[model samples]
Target: MSKKLTKNKKKYRDKISHNKKYSLEKAIEIIKKTNFVKFNASVDIAICLGIDPRLPDQMVRGSIKLPNGIGKNTIVLALVDQERELEAKESGADYVGLDYIEKIKSGWTDNIDVIVATPSVMNKLSILGKILGPKGLMPNPKMDTVSTDIKKSIEEFKYGKVFFKSDRYGIIHSSVGRISFSNQHLLENIKEFMRKIIQSKPSSSKGSYIKNVCLSSTMGSGSVSLDIKNFD
Candidate 1:
């Protein structure tokens, strides 16, 4: 840490005790105060779990719709029947139809966030697994991305539904909202995200399920550690 800190960084440093664990509410406030970016920064959360990632049964993964929608729009691509193309688009899908398969095969998966496909189209998509699987774009039933109801699935993701999966290091990372959002909205989103994580704990995991939680923005002021007990 250099003494030549910017006025904003100095203000944040003086206001926050880095070694101290803050309550969720207090953490959100601190995150808001510390953000010094010109653009509206995304409020991000990282939760460290106690489970071993090497164990298949200990994996934690699921999706949740935050009470308040995430400030960023979720760009969804819906793969459905020709008859359902209109329905998918009406449901808020950014891109719709099986025609996208040809585009996707040409290595054109840019600016797309989530992909929802009906079961009937999954077979056609199977051949493109080599292209989509590595990018985590392949639709799966577990995440509700592969469904008979393409409209419902697309709408859910279009609004706020987000999937979270523990990394190889046992940490789950996701954005709650943007710095421009009200602190209360951000707090509610964080609480809902934490609740989802708690609910997704694997049965095989033992000891402390969540070891640590941290909050930060897309830019500026770094991360603030939060008291895990507050989540319980």
Candidate 2:
């Protein structure tokens, strides 16, 4: 690697190392103690939990509008069959599409954040499995994208439905962000996310599905961990 490239890699590695360990209580304490600059800025925080990956589809996907709102601009994309394209458009989606597969495969997907799609379109796009697949943008039946409810899906996506999968260690990770948000706002968002995850526990699963959760800011600081049992 070039010297500059090597330096950048080292910086990135160092950054990751610094964020690897933290406690939820510490995270909550930070939120409780820190005086946020932005009244409602959206801050990005990650939650890590142990989950079962073998039961049906392992990925959990959903959206919620943090009660305080993310305090940031969010762009939403909705893909539907020709007949339902108008519904997506009328629902106030930033971008609506009847045929977005081609564009998505062509690398045009970099412009968007959230995506909502009807069953038909989602199925057809599955053919590009290799493309949207890696980016975690592919609509999955398990995640509820294969439905005809365009308006409802779009609205939910507008709020904060996140896609999460467990890592090799059985940990699912996701981010919540708004740079200027207050501690209270961040806490509420975290609580809402935890509620959804708890509600999704499978009946067959035993013991703790969520082993633990941790929160951190995008600025790359130490993480704060939360007690999963507290939610119980």
Candidate 3:
């Protein structure tokens, strides 16, 4: 029985490894075959674009229905005043309350992915600038996290109102779609995102703002490159 179990485990591991290798090779082939102009793939790719931080207000923030939804399950925390609290509850959020900011500060906000709050709560929580700020979970005005429209906000977030920002490498990372998504649908979503990024370029930035872009499966090896020169 022990020998059989060991053999089964080895088989499972070999199957996973083989699948990963094939996926990587296929991704490279897709990248090479697709030209910059007609290089649209059925898979959605992560896009990075340059922006001027000075004009922070111009950043785009809103919900979009990704043709293929992001695969990972998200836990949403709705922070609202007393009146809108009930509305938030009805909107299908995992957790809802005005005091959520305090809970977060107290280190109770584990396994939470998204946060929506009213403007008042945002002002109060701004004092926690250093804590949530580093995690990219900061409820900001630009991302529509602070809003009184509880229903609209909740619905939007459920779809895909992804909050994106640059990392230490100047790369803005956000999940565009799931691995199960069809290549065509993913490509369309990627194109739409790229179009928005290009349109959002600040007028103050003189040189080319969109430096480069690449896409990869999460936790998978090697990224396929995409050209942003004429990403319309």
lDDT of 2 by residue, 1-232 (tens): 3565456445543444333444444465554333233354334555554456655554444544456555555577787777777787887789887566777777787667666677666556767678767776666666655567879877666666555555555565666656455556666777777787777666666775676566655433345556565566
Give candidate 3's whole-model lDDT.
0.61
Q: Which candidate, 1 or 2, has the higher lDDT?
A: 1
- Please, what is the TM-score per model? 0.94, 0.71, 0.72
Tell me the deviation in Å of residue 107 in model 1: 0.5
| Sliding window of 10 residues with minimal summed lDDT for model 3 | 33-42
Per-candidate RMSD, Å: 2.3, 6.3, 8.2
Q: Which scores better on TM-score, 1 or 3?
A: 1
- Tens-place lDDT per residue, model 1, 69-168, is 8878899999899999999989999988888999999999989999999888888998889999888889989888999988788888988888888999
**Stretches of candidate 2 exceeding 4 Å from the true structure:** 1-26, 29-65
Error of 3 at 152 (Å): 1.0
Model 1 regions more than 4 Å off: 1-5
Off by over 4 Å in 3: 1-67
Model 3 C-alpha RMSD vs. true structure (Å) is 8.2
Ranking by TM-score: 1, 3, 2
Extract clashing residue pairs from model 1. Answer: none
